[model samples]
Target: MKLPDPPLNQASEIAGDWPLHGLAEDMRPALAQALARGAAGLATIISLGEGGPRPVGAQMVFGMESRAGFLSGGCIEADVEAHARACMADGRPRRLVYGEGSPWPDIRLLCGARIEILVERLASDDDAARALLALAEAREPAAWISDGERRLCAPASDPAPTWPGAFSRRFDPPPRLVVFGGDPTALAVASLGAQSGFSTTLVRPKGPIAPPPLAGVAYRRDDVAGAVAAVGLDAWTAVAVCGHDEEVDHEALLAALPSAASYVGLLGARRRLGARLDRLRAAGVAETDLQKLRAPIGLDLGGKAPFEVAVAIIGEIMASRHGQPALARRPVSTPDGDGQAAKPPGGGKS
Candidate 1:
């Protein structure tokens, strides 16, 4: 069965002022009342002139009772409430940004991302309201909410014919992980990938067979593009090469590297996988494209066994899934005269 979709929320940084949980709670009754009357309730969000502190998939839902979709840890809800109340009072649409790189400690946390948030006054006919209605009616993840500058849109399996909302964010299909090989380590890694909320395909090269813990998994054939064909793989997906067969690993790498999967990893130590990369590149993979592959996958957890190794690998995948900053992976550089040197970030940087 498919996984339940995550709720949608608008970015606070896009709307100048962060949304207040208390304000949404307070606003709920009025909005709910509007919904009760069968009238349309529209909500619009955009990046503030700068940015807000929220993840890409954050959301805000305005029901009759003013429910908060996903919010910042409720740190600055008071200010957000005041902003919401003022917007309701003034009957106007406005733009605001928390930080412009100045020293506003509250707004400008050094998170490395810029934010811009927009809160526009919406009536029944507003596009955002209509699109939101579509999502609400069908429980569709098709609505991609954007703050104008940076948008987050996820596709829906069954979307309504027309999206009556006025929001434009690049709609991205949900991310998936394509796991190759049918060994215990591969299964363990796939199991952890499922836990991290990725669509996984367990490829058994020998033929069709079932694994033990068949929960939250979608097995696939070992042929080329099997995972890609089974479930759509965009730049968000991560492909990992595990299992003992070098032949199987090579085929999986050949299939995955060129695709749009965001992260490509091969489960092996440095020396072994490094040779594979060299061969793939020598076989015509570009230098830049070759850089995208993550060999010696996972963090250096000092792990030594299958489960321990799986743990480290999963940690890396988790970091990649959420776009988390990668930890340093130590590397050794060979000098021109055959000398070697230690590089920055360490071996686990990939």
Candidate 2:
């Protein structure tokens, strides 16, 4: 269904910071409020060039005078908000480009990159917004297509429109991190995961030891296998087993290995990893599948504290998610044909 432009006069300026916490799930409350007030507008990043601050499909929900998320760095939000107001006034979608050679010569993006934003006015009961929310809840990836006269959501596999000026943007579910175990380390990792924009969940088996309180993280009390299934691990999900219990770690690994999870990490020393692998193989997990597991999970950041380890783990997960090499190093050969390090990865002395 096509959404009509909202009345520009209906908005009133409100004072507060943008409520964004870096996840689409965090925008639900603002979206619902804007829709209920009949002042909702959708702003999305349709295209982003090299070095762009935000990736394509990043979006925000705007009310007449309030915003709930961010589209770019501080450089472009004001202009995008102004265009959104215009879209509401005219019942039409507006496309805005910012960055190098932009019409506003005075405004320069810090990264000197280009981005395209599409703003569309939405009504209180907009079907398109509802559809997008449904897909998000289901954790399904889909394409949002608009051709001026109509707006619709389709499967991710749908072909893009060939018509001139038509736009299609794909939206995927937010990345999820499921941490198994209720130890202090697990709590720290879960906290870091949430702060880093992942939908974080802490799962631990029911026992006499109570789980620690973790703010902004969902808590689950179930066996490892059940918890894995409950979280609905997808290709965007990362599972980390942090408990010291071998049985718990083994069960979590078994459950996660068969899934399409982008990362499966086990927290322990190198020695424990070998024993765990042996158990997993004895339990019928294939050797090739075991290769996907990251034992002694986390980058070698040389920090032994719980928080430092958590940072390393989250860093590795982010690197894996973005397809970046976890370690940055230049290899050098010694006279004996053995490898010698010139400099440590991520800028450090050898």
Candidate 3:
């Protein structure tokens, strides 16, 4: 199915309220509401140019009364919302563009980049949409494809089907964070992890200690070693052992090291980590596997507070997830001929 060419003169007004950054999982509630009301539209970024505010596959769901997710750095959402409303009215998908030389003269994307967005009418009962939602809800990886007229959803492990003039987007399950501890520090890590889009699970080893409040986290109670196995670590999972107990830390490390988890971090001092590693080696864990643990985990942010420590740990996890170096390097300023430091160009945050 072919999409209708967008009208060159079509323009949209500004929407005052911008939505928050979120993934497909976070937008499920809004999508469900939209579907129930029979007035929902989905806008997806199918293509993006260099320096675009948002990457390809970024999406937003719009309901008659509310919207969830974001498409850009707060520049084109209003216009996108207008296009989405139009799609809901006509039930026809259309491609919209913003930024340099855009057809919509009223919208000027300040990011100095271009993006192609596809807006389509959506319903709760849509077979393809429901399939995609189910995969996301289950934290399963999948790929979704659409040709504006037709949509297809496939498991990530399956070969993608080809469709001429279609755009495809891969959706991975949200990164899973397994925090082993019931302490305040572990609670902080889980809380921040949840807000940062991780499917956080707080695992407390069986004990007299009470569990932390689980407003946005999954609570698991098991022996430290058993909890690791119960969580079923995957390549997208990160394990953080924050308990100060030597035995608990050692057991958690043993389970995490041999798993497919991309990151395994333990909170402790250098000497403590050394003792733990020795214990692991004596317990039959291979030296090579023991080396995989990030003992005294987190970058050296130098803050001693629990929240600060959580920030460092989360930051390190993100860097590791993206294959980034352990240490962040700041741009070095060069001296100009006049003996003044030359400032970097376009220095503001993106």
Number of the top TM-score candidate: 3
Provide the overall lDDT of each model, using Cα atoms, as 2-decimal numbers. Answer: 0.52, 0.70, 0.73
Q: How well is each residue in 67-123 modelled by candidate 1, as lDDT tens digits?
A: 453334443333344444444445443343444432333553354444333444444
Which model is ahead, 1 or 3, in terms of lDDT? Answer: 3
Which of the predicted structures, 1 or 2, would earn the higher TM-score when compared with the native?
Answer: 2
Tens-digit lDDT string for candidate 2 (48-164): 889787877677778866676776656667666777777777777876667764554455677888877778887777776677677877888877776544677765766754455
For model 1, the stretches where C-alpha displacement exceeds 4 angstroms are 1-57, 60-171, 321-350
Please report, as a residue range, the 10-residue window in candidate 2 with the lowest summed lDDT. 341-350
| Candidate 2 global lDDT | 0.70
| TM-score computed on alpha carbons, candidate 2 | 0.80
Tell me the tens digit of each residue's lDDT in model 3 across 218-258.
87777876677667888889998887576777788888988
Q: After the best TM-score superposition of candidate 2, give how far the Cα of residue 47 lies from its true spot, in angstroms.
A: 4.1
Best by lDDT: 3
